[model samples]
Target chain A: MKRISCDSSSIIALSSNCLMWVLDKFETEFIIPFYVKKEIIDTPLKGKKYSFEAMKHGLLIGNTLKVKETDPILRDKIIKLSNTLLSHKGKPIEIIQYGEADAIALAIKEDVSTLLVDEKNTRLLIEDLEGLKKVIERRTGRDFEINKTSAQELNKLLKGLKIIRSTELIAVAIKRGFFDWPYPRADIVKNALTALKFSGCAISSKEINETVDILTQTH
Target chain B: MKFALDALNFFKKTDTKLLRNLSDKILIDGFIEKNNELINLSIVVHSLSKICEKDYYKKDGVYWKTFVDKIQANLEEVASDKAQVIILEKIIVELDNHFGRYKNNVLHRSKIRKGSTLYAWGVSLTLASQMVKIPEIELMKQIGRTKIVDEEAQIKTISERLKDAEEIL
Candidate 1:
């Protein structure tokens, strides 16, 4: 079976807006790293407010998503390289947690090419070196330098690893007739995409308008 | 030196609004300096500022002291530099004890709230989470609730990402 790997945050984004059900609509198997399972299902289950949302995700894990064990050695290397890839004030900026790193490692280990991730930093670190440099500068009001060795090593590992957010997933799902939009209003797809953004999918207004344009125009 | 004293003074005064400047300072300095201690201090001040400003009773003197007095005692014992991280960790325990019902990691909510405020200030999600040591997932959820991403430009076009999703499916 074909598979796509996703981290916990994407699931959190999907579950936040009632879009987790769309996972079942695809022929592809949605797999998560073991650590990703702990992040989405085990850890959040203990919190008061998030416990209920966590339980909902637990059901999706059991019924729809498959859990796969990742290579710990590979996962750690990714974490170490990624956290040290960018530098600030003569110190390496630590980015990408074990959960995000483990998710990427599982994809590499399993030969999965597409990763569904909603966190902006992980995507930026993987796809945009200069964009990330500007973010660091803008946020800190200071300049930062990058460690080229770590950057090359990280790029070698993440080469050809395609990243997409939950917003895009919903757009694709809607394009393919996700069951949720039945008896749809003209604005349903746009609304659904917008809802995912407001629910923390890290989508921009321009992207949302553009997505709405493509999806609605073709619909 | 000055930050620690201001934190102490912020606690001493009835006005929680003073936290805005202190928080702005830490947010900028914490990222530029790449300092964990400043980041920890940032989380504490930002969380207290939000909590006090939003909640009615927390703004009042006696009720405010209930929270501040405890942070103050811990502040008194430590050197100014170390006081920030210590007080942050202590507040997690204090809040858990105060609520008395939820399991641990409840303060994940509070920690991520402060983390999102950093995101609003134009820091990347990973940088903000890394600074405060919160998970990306937790911080992402807070970002959704706050909808701060609406302000920033999207790095990739939506149509381009749609193709990626379609290819995977």
Candidate 2:
């Protein structure tokens, strides 16, 4: 069976109406990390559709992926190193050693697992994982590989649902109260639609127009 | 990991001198580097756009109505008008917390000068009044008159004073 690991970012991006449609088309098994599961069900999810409901019915596979916490010592090391590096500027050392760190550590232990993470952090994270594999291969004569799916690709899956249009996803998100305004709604809409289109969902222009109307009225 | 508390310290009273000691290159570059997340960058850009929106909403005379509706929907409170008002107030506070720094921009500067409470009041009262079928002129007159000398009052005027705060669509 083909195994894929998913995180909170993937689920959040996939929740778009259009993107969710495309994701429904996939039959592959997707894994969820323990921390990511916690984030999805937490209080902040109070009224969201993806709230504990997304998992209660087994839409997302929450059991297959492993959980890994940061080693206290290693975490301390990153902090200490960052503190010194940042001391001159008198800036606070805000080294994030948990979220991605846990994901990376768990991925290493899973052995050749494909991770689904946001694109901005992917390059740096993959490089770190590759470096670890290199060190281990040199010492133990063994190697492992990893792959990924970006937020954009996961979004395109929404179009497959065919219930909404890619362009209307942002309006839906806002109307659904997924995001508050005082931010660029257009940009948000663009980002949401980009994700759906990239996810491989096909949508018609007419559908986009209808969605815009619904969103305008409701939002 | 950098906690909010750590960032808070950088703004201490004594840091007045320290701020000058630090170069713009060091501080600005460090901030961008640390917040390289797409969401973080998006937040900055989004906040900038809202000011312009607030302006649009103000002009159409539907600013308060839309703002209250959004808050009510978010909190899932359909029956309680008071609850809706309270939630709208909180939402305004939250928006300020996130984008308060940009209050001086051409778009939000007017809102800030008018104050957050006034802005909230304008939006809430105007929106509430409209839903209840109150005439626009009456709603404006009623909301326009207030002696609640507090930050909330200031916030109310912030949205009202906008050049075009009522262009929802």
Candidate 3:
């Protein structure tokens, strides 16, 4: 079966928006590694505010989304590569961590070409390193020493991995009629995408409008 | 660590200005030493300085003195060892015990804020989330609401990513 490795950000966003049902309906398998399970399910289960949401996520793994194990060695290598890719004032800026690396490793292990994630860091690193450099420099207003060697190595490992955020995921789903929101007459796609943006999907106003424009054009 | 002693002296003087400076120093030390406790402490200390600087935190009666006394006692007595996650949770909890005005769980909110600060300083979302022990979703929203993680800086167009999402699953 075809598979897409998923990280915690996408899962949490989907769960918050009551969109986990789409995982079960899609023909492609969504794999969540053990470390991601610990993040989105186990850890949150022990917390106060999002425990119930974590339970809802746990149920998804049990019933629909498959839980898989990742290569710990690969995960550690990716984390080191990502963190060491840039330096600030002679210190290596610690970038990506365990949860994101776990999904990357799982996708590499499974030979999957795509990763489902919402956060920008790992995605920007994979999609465009130069772009990420510009973004970081613009944000911090400080010069970061980019280790070209480390960037090349990390890019070699992460080559061809595509990122799909929850906003895009839901937009496609709504366009495909996946999100069955009850209020039928409401602009379901637009409304759902807006909710996703506010609820932690890392989408911009322009991106939201662009997506809504394309997705709603057929309607 | 000298930070412990610095924290102690600041507690004695109750100097909100110096405390804010100390917080900045501790945050820089956090990046250098990879110390989670120091980062959390820096956040809470920042919060404490903000609180102390404001007149709103002042109480009219002896209750204010008691509140200050209580905070001073708690902070002064925090041993250098075993200062892992306790600094963040403990300080926030102590404040909650005294100030019933906060609308939300200050500890949780601080963690998200800390994660945002770290991300804006060039830490990855996942790394910042892991350091502050917050869900990436929460931290992402916190940072997303800010202009620090500028979307326009990204190279790919939204439609390209949208096409990938539409085609993949």
> How close is candidate 2 at the interface, in terms of C-alpha RMSD after superposing the true interface residues?
22.2
The 10 consecutive residues of candidate 3 chain B with the worst lDDT sum are B76-85
- Give lDDT per model, in order: 0.72, 0.33, 0.74
> Which stretches in model 2 have alpha-carbon errors above 4 Å?
A17-28, A47-59, A62-97, A128-193, A197-219, B1-169
Per-residue CA lDDT of candidate 3, range B85-119, in tens?
37445655666656774536556676677778777
lDDT measured at residue B138 in model 2 versus the true structure, 0 to 100: 27
Report fnat in order of the candidates.
Answer: 0.54, 0.01, 0.50
User: How many Å off is the CA of B63 in candidate 3?
Assistant: 4.1
Winning candidate number (lDDT)? 3
Candidate 3 regions with alpha-carbon error over 4 angstroms: A179-186, B1-29, B53-56, B60-63, B66-92, B101-107, B144-152
Candidate 3 clashes: the total is 0
Chain B TM-score by candidate, in order shown:
0.70, 0.20, 0.70
DockQ of 3: 0.48
Q: Largest TM-score belongs to which candidate?
A: 3
* Model 2 C-alpha lDDT per residue in residues B36-144, reported as the tens digit of each score: 2211212222232343345443444455445444543533441222232234334544445444433334323322322222212221222222222222222222222
